[model samples]
Target: MTDSSSSPITVRYTCPHCDAVHSIDRAPDLADRSVTKHSQPGWEYATPDDDLEVRETADGIAFICGEDGPVTDLEGKQIEGCGRPFYLNFVRFEQGVELDPNPATYGGPRFDFNG
Candidate 1:
């Protein structure tokens, strides 16, 4: 990933099916949250608005095509891209390592519910 302590970190990849170039800008601090305490190198979440759910790891990142349907530009015009799920593998040492789907879970909740 590009280094920048304050600026947004941009991740770029090519679509597998359509070969379209895509870029995602993430907060610089996102790198810090990418890894779990258990050392599992990744993070997964759905956007609060329920669009663009993605899973990212040291090995790679996977994105659901168009979130729900065709992706749109800031003006709401549809941008051309294959509406299919795709994975981008981060090649390391000439190989791509896959992460375990289930990593060690963090110990339950921080506060007691009965309070």
Candidate 2:
């Protein structure tokens, strides 16, 4: 897994009440379109705006505090992948990209790739 912190479009969310920022990472809303890349079929997606409901920041973006972390929804934030009452994440990994998992219990090689 490669460190995505410096990814092209890295996102983060913050809590307005307690000022506690919970990185929200959820899937996108694409019901009518099928994202296929090199035979890698992407999943469908939807956003919170569809339902006219705003989540936390309403920034319309999703982000994970780190790898292996629970997904969160920025609510009102405008994130790339999110929907009505979202709690997941959606992202497109371009070709030649690398992923570096965080240093947690699941330890092994510093990085990995499906192919």
TM-scores of all predicted structures: 0.36, 0.18
What is the lDDT of every predicted structure here? 0.43, 0.29
Worst lDDT window (10 residues) for model 2?
30-39
What is the TM-score of candidate 2? 0.18
Per-prediction CA RMSD (Å): 13.8, 15.9
| Model 2 spans > 4 angstroms off | 1-8, 25-115
In model 1, what lDDT does residue 74 have? 43
Tens digits of per-residue lDDT, candidate 2, 39-84, equal: 1223233343332223222322222222323334444433233211
Error of 2 at 16 (Å): 0.6
**Global fold similarity of model 1 (TM-score):** 0.36
Candidate 1 per-residue lDDT over residues 7-112, each given as its tens digit: 6556544455555455665444343212222222354343213322232224445555455334544444557666665654332332455333333333543543
